[model samples]
Target: MAWNLDSQRPIYAQIIERVQYDIVSGHYNPGDKLPSVRELACEASVNPNTMQKALSELEQSGLVYSQRTTGRFITKDTSCIRKIREELAKQQVLEMIRRMKQLGFTKEETLTLMDKIYEEATYEHTIGV
Candidate 1:
């Protein structure tokens, strides 16, 4: 999953985003120890230095922490994780609204479309889509 990177953006930034998503989404739970930098680099097919930079950035952001002679672990702060989750959701919503406006849809129309889509999606999920 970490290998799904693109050339349009910085690889380390992408790695940070992926790791953050993993943490917030519960793929890596609170206090879970992370794999070694070399291991993550191997998994992402990136240079170890790139993975280190990403992890360091995440550490500075308080999402990850390290102990002496021990590996990095996900932060145990559920509130911080929740805040990050909301921030990510808001980013997606903002981008969706931006695209809708670009397509000439007003706020009301966008909301209506969203409602319809949500209903259809809910129905599909109920039916085991």
Candidate 2:
């Protein structure tokens, strides 16, 4: 995994987001083992403590669980994965809406754009594009 350290967000927060994205994207599937904090920190060139904190936050969020000696693994619950996906989708939509508002888009225009997006996404899914 590559770290974009120059991003506006804090490194730890970006690390958490990257891990979450990996989970959601199936790069780290349910019940799959995750790299140790030290390993991940080395890979990302981040502090071990920061990586640990991010993993701890994931544990707190129920996206991952720790087992004695075996280390941490992704959650096996499908509902938990679905919940994470829903929450991420809601966050992305809220951010997009906020940006639109800042750009002076009217509510009706935002809704129309969202409808168009939905149609495009549906078409993409239908055509496997």
Candidate 3:
């Protein structure tokens, strides 16, 4: 439940991103009830209204839903979750490629670096790095 906020962007936006990341990272599984606004606010050290605003936005985006007498829950739509995951992955890859190019690597060289990095990462993962 780490909350990282900075002065550049609004806190609520950061909350939304963090929550979305949690869902995609399996920290909050599909159909899981989110922590209450007060709880989340406390965890994130922000005003309850800010957390509420963030959660409301998430619901509007169809990544979360609310039920009467219950609470907000992660969307059970696996396809939507998969799509979000894909979008996030694409963002990461593009950012990495941009950085690589800035470091003077050509597209093919950048891709080859990606393969090397991926192999090392996979090996580390397999050995519980």
TM-score of each: 0.94, 0.84, 0.88
Name the top TM-score candidate: 1
Q: Which candidate has the top score in lDDT?
A: 1
lDDT of 2 by residue, 1-129 (tens): 467675576788888888888899899999999999999999999999989999999999999999999999999997999898888899998998899999999999999987898789888886444
Judge candidate 2 at residue 43 and give its lDDT.
93
Q: How many backbone clashes does candidate 2 have?
A: 0
Q: What's model 3's lDDT at 18?
A: 86
Candidate 2 or 1, higher TM-score: 1
Error of 2 at 79 (Å): 1.0
Ranking by lDDT: 1, 2, 3
Question: All candidates' lDDT scores?
Answer: 0.92, 0.90, 0.89
Backbone clashes, each candidate: 0, 0, 0
Candidate 1 residue lDDT tens string, 15-61: 99899899987899999999999999999999999999999999999
Question: What would the per-residue lDDT of candidate 3 be over residues 1-129, giving only the tens digit for each residue?
Answer: 457788598999988888889999999999999889999999888999999999999999899999978999999999988888898899898998888889999988887887898789888895444
lDDT of 1: 0.92
Model 3: residue 63 alpha-carbon error in angstroms: 0.6
